[model samples]
Target: MLGSISLDKTTRRVSLRAKALMIFSILLAPGCLGSDEEIDVFYGEDIVPPRATPDFVLFDQNGDPVAFNDYLGDVVVVAFLFTRCPDVCPQVSANMAWIGNELGDNLGTEVHLLSITVDPWYDNSSVMQNYAYDRGLEWPHLSSDLETMEPIWRSFDVGLETYANDTDGDGTVDGFDLCPDTPEGEQTDADGCGVETQQSEGDVQTMHHPLYYIDHTTGTIIVDRAGNQRVYWGDFVWNADMVLDDIMALVEESA
Candidate 1:
């Protein structure tokens, strides 16, 4: 009986060893772990080019033609947003406003804020004017016809989608809607867009209601005085202070 038990134990040990070897072989086999080149291709990091501003021309909120070349000696922060955006767009614009206020007297002189509307058709001069006024944004809020705006959007990689919905039951579908189901007479951004804000509180029992804006991309391009595009802050993650610091650095470098 002892001899038979020893034989069974040895057989079990051999089986376990074989299984381990098979698993190792599969892991190290060709096409199993993938080649080094293939791994690099899959996991490699992208290298972004150094900032340099590109040439552009569009109409401002007043229907006045504006060109990048016109501001050859000044620094410009160009942002893409629609007047009616409910989410990140408002945040981005607000941040820009903060930056502008921080800059104070140097706004249009040393630094210029150019907000290009993604929704050109609905965001005409008057609509853009109201948006600017409501937000107290002193910068140029501009848009052009679709034919002109399409290429500009492509150049900036700004993607926008329009939908039709009558959330207010007012018998008219408004432009720039993220959630078309919202009821009418509800307070919204300049574009009559989606919900205004979102809310989240801490672990305590108290309630916290924060502003909720739309989910639009928040990419603001910073162009230096040398016409080089220096920095790009995507989404609303970047605050006014950080943007201002970079701008100051660029200004010092230019000087």
Candidate 2:
């Protein structure tokens, strides 16, 4: 596990924990911190600096346009993944869902979660909504046309997932998982779409807005109120408890 201060934008990072690949696991060096402090675990590809974030607008799952700057005053945890992600993508989003639940009432008030789709050509509005609803996510799951999202992807160095899978056991793959979050014990049609209404539909979704090519490349960026990109977690750092600790510490420090 590796953790350290990020000096500049080109800081290459690597996780200090083991990463799960397919059904096997790869043990790695541990680098988690008991307290919240600036730590860099980047292996390569230099750490992207805490520079001024450019403003970009995209339709969320609910099909509403939102500006990134609008989230400045809140603690925002952003991840790059598509609903059809087979392995790490679902794992990363599931981690965020865990965090969102743990945040309790502070979810929308003090903190927010952002999942941006790297695959736009297929992950349209409906697919985005199903992805979040199935994951018990209360945050905005975003995506857009490739032309609109190209720069956004490049800006954040988020790898595009040109493909997808049926990770939800709902029978539908990412691009076609229209009813992504079918409730457990519920029967789904030929498509993976399931009824989450009887279950928990935490937050509403928006549409047209929004990775999985690199190893342990599931990047999570925590942006503070001031928009100074604060903490950065590697692909394998999906432990909700560990992330919750770091986020809480950071929020407390900022206050």
Candidate 3:
């Protein structure tokens, strides 16, 4: 009788487990657990709002002028970065490279990647060309003088700041930023592009930081064929698959 009771208890447990799984499946099924509006609220459908890629004229690594209007019909991924960035900039570039590789031939044809350097003072055409060659980047690397580059950077909301420091500065910070005037121990944007917006007054403050980096409220922006900003992926850490999904989504929407 003891053995029979043990078997019955085991059977009851299994039955409970099966019931739990069934309930879980029902909860996960579309239109079962929550309404469409509820799902949208939970998942955040407007995270990335589409925006237009503003028109700009910048010289590619080859010294040829490339304009936004020239690539009007193609899907473009624009990234603002500098070759001298020690942290996030390289990661962002690598992420773009991965997206291009994942897309294969679709990159040059269906999509194009544009990288604009914030350090135009040092990242001239030759410097950009060498950096692109070393990284095996097939995309365009564009830059211009500070005077010319400022307007472009401002258009994208990138801020810039410069400081003077020589404590082990040695002119180059690991080939990331060539700003020898940059002060030692000064905090900068993650990408080393420039300074932050809305500076706070300190108890003791002296110099002001110039804005150079883009304030990318939306980590990624998707511009559709109709020239309308259609998708905005705000603060979304990008990956190849996710980018592909975004492209496919836009393509399908256009179709």
Candidate 4:
């Protein structure tokens, strides 16, 4: 776990406990003598000397152009996911939804949430729309062609790759395969496993479907009202309450 800290754009930082104590005594406590401003500390990895988030205009689930700059005055939470992802993507989405619900009336006003696809080749505007609707997520799920999304992905430090892996020599790529372990040189079904693997007997069924699996960084970034990336919480280590605290802290900051 990365230690938290209180940081500002000039790379000035202080220990979390020290800053917490200071804030409590000077900013929160009654009759304390100090400036009216409050210092914020985060529970996630802080971006020291924070930098501006790359701005882009992408189509949302509704096929309407959405610009990142338009959300400058709001704290933004950006999540990277793909519609076809079988595991981590959905978990990340659920985490984001939890944060969204906790935001309450502040959502879409003081805080903006966005989910951008890592597999834009497959997750077009319609696919993004369907995914969002099916999952009951009201936030914008953005998608565009690979050419347009690559630079944005790079700017956000999103590590991404697509693979056509067939671990058991099956004709079908692992992405679309329901069964993963097919025998060598055996014909497979649409699900990528032979009858021997699927049924109780040794028989080879012939069918193939080509697909690619996308592996990407499953993390969410919190951008401050200044449009700078401030905190990052990886999907595997997310704590909903801590994430919410980080966001609200930024929302409390003066513009």
Candidate 5:
């Protein structure tokens, strides 16, 4: 179950729809490994990240420049996202929102979260801000031009990923398909959408760019006090309780 928020801010909807499924990284059995003395130092998908996250200068929702170091002294949960992604990313954000709510006093104190875009070409600071606000998000939703963000993606080892909307469940993608979101189970033409697909609201594209909508990377990383990456989960396949346990442990340790 997703945890509840008790922070100073008024309670906000956590999901577009109620009680969305919560996903985490791959799970590990508690006793599957050897015994008492050895510590379960890492959880979910383990990573060998750099001693500290590479410093990044990116644009915030307000179009102002912000850097990674600005969040120093707080353990940061960082993820890469794109606005139009239809899948995993949205759920990931919801999960983070739950975490943020749970953090309460710890937020901006012991913990902070950052989300950078993989499709910065399409998701400018303005677009990103709208996306974050729509989702009732509190963390930074950041981006820059594709050229400026490529190095950041490289440093984090995440590739650009997106998908086209087939609003009518059409077999083909939007741009070349000329039609999109074909009605479910309906037989479609070569374009994979029906003749009326154009009338569908999905036809309109965004302001800055026309990139494919994408799925989230389904990963999150935790950086500790010394700036070392402490944990990483490649997908939302594990448990939030475990994450909370680990995060609280780290927060106390850092204190």
Candidate 6:
């Protein structure tokens, strides 16, 4: 059900290796290639030859076990985010909410959404519930212990790492340092020690820093009805209308 690209002068193979090159081309010229007729190309990075998405079981905000395979029949938008992410994560979630509003009743029917946490250590069930509730996003925000979650992160190609680097010589790592450029050797509060769990405060800046950040891939992946990854939209460059078109195309294809 993935959309096709119309290229008047370009020839490219459809594979993961080719995806990078296509992304470059997409950035330069986003739509059709022909001069006379405009053809529809995916606004998001297209996975030419779609790859099967890995399946996993993770805990939702309710601490309920949800398996990826269980949602195979629906077109799922899988977004990787952390509640502690300063900016990008909330933007992606808001975009998802817009898409949900556009979907109307179809939000939970033919199409579905998932928000998986990159920082599972601090994004536990209660924290995730608060995140969803505060944002009015009624989708699964999932997490698990590192042992159970690391494999899932790898499967999804999430580039994840945690480190303690205090650039200002503060006792806290940069990830947890609210005042990253604090004057060197100046005594500060325990802000760098990390929070037990971060809640969704209105201001991203006011949120407590984690002991260390779970820096990982940032984006949403569209999975087709058969559990294959079809397209990817970077968190920062989401086009809600185009994303909806892709979802409807997949849903209509199944119909």
Question: Model 4, which residues run further than 4 Å from truth?
Answer: 1-40, 167-169, 174-181, 184-191, 199-210
lDDT (tens digit, per residue) of candidate 5 on 73-179: 77888777778665567877877887887777888888888888887657898889899999899678888887888777766666555566555555555643554
Candidate 4: C-alpha RMSD to true structure equals 8.7
Candidate 2, overall lDDT?
A: 0.61
Instruction: State the lDDT of candidate 6 residue by residue for 33-102, as single tens digits.
Output: 4455433345687775577888899999999999999998999999999897777888888888888877
Best by TM-score: 4
lDDT of each candidate versus the true structure:
0.62, 0.61, 0.58, 0.78, 0.64, 0.74
Off by over 4 Å in 1: 1-47, 163-218
lDDT of 3 by residue, 69-145 (tens): 77667666677777765456777777777777666656777777788887876789998998889888878899988
Minimal lDDT window, size 10, model 6: 8-17
What TM-score does candidate 1 get on C-alpha atoms?
0.61
What shift in Å separates residue 142 of candidate 4 from its native position after superposition? 0.2
User: What would the per-residue lDDT of candidate 1 be over residues 18-114, giving only the tens digit for each residue?
Assistant: 4543564476677787455321110111113434456777888787888987887888888988775656788888888777876666678888889
Q: Report how far off residue 245 is in candidate 5 (Å).
A: 2.4
Error of 4 at 253 (Å): 1.9
Q: Cα RMSD to native, each candidate? A: 19.7, 13.9, 14.9, 8.7, 9.5, 10.2
TM-score of 5: 0.67
Best by lDDT: 4
Error of 6 at 5 (Å): 24
**How does model 6 score by TM-score?**
0.73
TM-score order of candidates, best first? 4, 6, 5, 1, 2, 3
Using all chains and alpha carbons, the TM-scores for the candidates as numbered come to: 0.61, 0.60, 0.59, 0.76, 0.67, 0.73
